[model samples]
Target: MSAAFEIFLQGTPGLEEALAEEARATGFAKAEAVPGGATLQGQWTTVWRANLKLRGAGAVLARIGGFPASHLSQLDKRSRAFPWGDVLRPGVPVKVEMSTSAKSKIYHAGAAQERIERALSESFGATIDPEATVVLKTRIQRDYVQFSVDTSGESLHKRGHKPAVGKAPMRETLAALFLRQAGFTGEEPVLDPMCGSGTFLIEAGEMAAGLWPGRDRRFAFEDLATFKPDLYARIRSEAPQPRPLEELPGLFGSDRNAGAIEMAGRNAEAAGLGGAVTLAHRAVSDLERPAGPPGLVIVNPPYGARIGDRKQLFSLYGRLGAVLKERFGGWRAAIVTSDGGLARATGLPILPPGPPVAHGGLTVKLYQTAALR
Candidate 1:
């Protein structure tokens, strides 16, 4: 084993446990949930699996090395002593992010950063850039420091497929995690009544088809000198491709904004899922169940934070409830919103609700209502 690894998952406040639960189910043994992250033990294969499978994880990191540092000089010396050649190449540009805790005497972050940067550059000629192809973060909490490299270059949520988006759009990773929470499999018809940019719908299609989330992109670690490219290639070659579109369930989505729907269609097509994703210009009020007896209906409507009014959202929720109860009674529904009061206004008798998940600095709840009468 190289070392005990840490996998960092980022999302709205309430979704940590949900994301942790999913990570555990996906062979990440001994998974422990923390605020904004989950640390688990696994090898490089686990790291690779995480980037490919995790829907809620915003970033996956591999712990390169670290040691305790009482002062700035100790921090610099310990950092320089790390085997940079083991993980980083000489030519690749890198970025450094540092955070200090109360126990550390290194009050000046810039000074601390400069020391580490100088150490790396002088020792290995490693370049640092914020927009670089690779990023390494040094976090000093209390007197201990942890050095980690971001294996997932962009946030895993990017998925590199969505070129266009709408206001207040839901992230692909969050949508995947929510779908799992709502018991969504790719085998059932899914309707996103207020689908913005079709993230949920596209993710649903990918999930049902067993499509690897990282299939369309390259990882930052691939460029590292010590990275086992052969091992990674073997892992990728052996991964099970999505069963077949015919065997998976169809996906459906709609939005009041025709532009969002158009963008969603284009994004889905770009992801090679145009045939699997069905998007249309439709309002939540007009949502209805097709011939399917019961499927999953997920809506991420505006929570009065941005385009919609807060008081007005109550009416919208009420109308949405009416539509769900009358038109899609048997289907399972999941609604994501920042407003708890507006969620209750839907009058759907949802359960106690899960913990708050963080989304763009806001605490959003994944509200679910099932067993509709």
Candidate 2:
């Protein structure tokens, strides 16, 4: 645990590069984007810092140790021999989850998981609970078995601040990544005209104020054997103090539903952005440019896929586009939707869409526009 090991920052499937960029910006110098996440080398302290600071990572996984196991017996023997004491504390509840590939001789994931769970229970004197907060993820691929611990107990998107979520509300992780993808560096105003539960604007406010996303929450790493309370306390205390919200750029959101507006307001307040963010109960057609330099106008409007009629949405999108064209000149826009037809209805001179992002059982894409003229 003292030595540097691979730390995987699990990211949104299509937003791994954005997560990597964020990791590098946050001083993880060797962060590199891979298929599922970004990988970097770090010790236990790095894992703690990652859980505390990384906004885009869904979970922080520490790759503790692994070995090759071509057969079930080999897997059991190796699992028992793994230094679980160095990571898992005795009597602490743990869950073992496994995934296997066709190329691996240990193709039965359940069997592999049972073997590992038995090893933890019998060899390491650990408690195996299916409902445990701490998770030990095992992957068997191409005859290689890899063991990683999910240090972020819940998905990082939970953020633990927003208890009021609207229908099809965007995850905080996706919102942060989308904000980054839209070139938002927290230097200017951000308005989500269709803001549901205020995720985008609150995240923007938090970013601008230099608040750590995980400050208000606990991580699964704290339950691991390697966690050092004093070291983690130092790391928490070392984080930059939040800048006064008034000194930062404005963050605004509006929704046609009054309930949504109220929900966003409450969520913003919970995130310590109550005074910073402006939430209004208004329609997109009522959205007006704020009195300031142009910034990002990002929206995750309803698409026909899950909520509304497809034909009716075109008109809504068309109106939204017209409003932006007329009122939000010089502001860049990013629209997220599953339907290209709905996005095209905006007629905002969109650049090519980014890679598809999975959200709420739909494959959505971000259609961004250059600064609107």
Error of 1 at 291 (Å): 0.9
**Residue-by-residue lDDT tens digits, candidate 2, 49-110:** 99889899999999988999999999999999999999987778999888999999899999
lDDT of 1 by residue, 1-373 (tens): 3665555655445677777887888777677778777878777677887887777788888877788888888978877788898778888998998878877777677888898898888877888777887888888887888888888888888887778888887788888888988888666788888887889988888888777788878888787774787788887886686666666576888888899899989998877788877777878778757765578888888887755679878888898888888988678778888888888998897877767777766778888987577
- Alpha-carbon lDDT of model 1: 0.80
Q: TM-score for each prediction?
A: 0.94, 0.98
TM-score of 2: 0.98
Give candidate 1 regions above 4 Å deviation: 1-12
Backbone clash total, candidate 2: 0
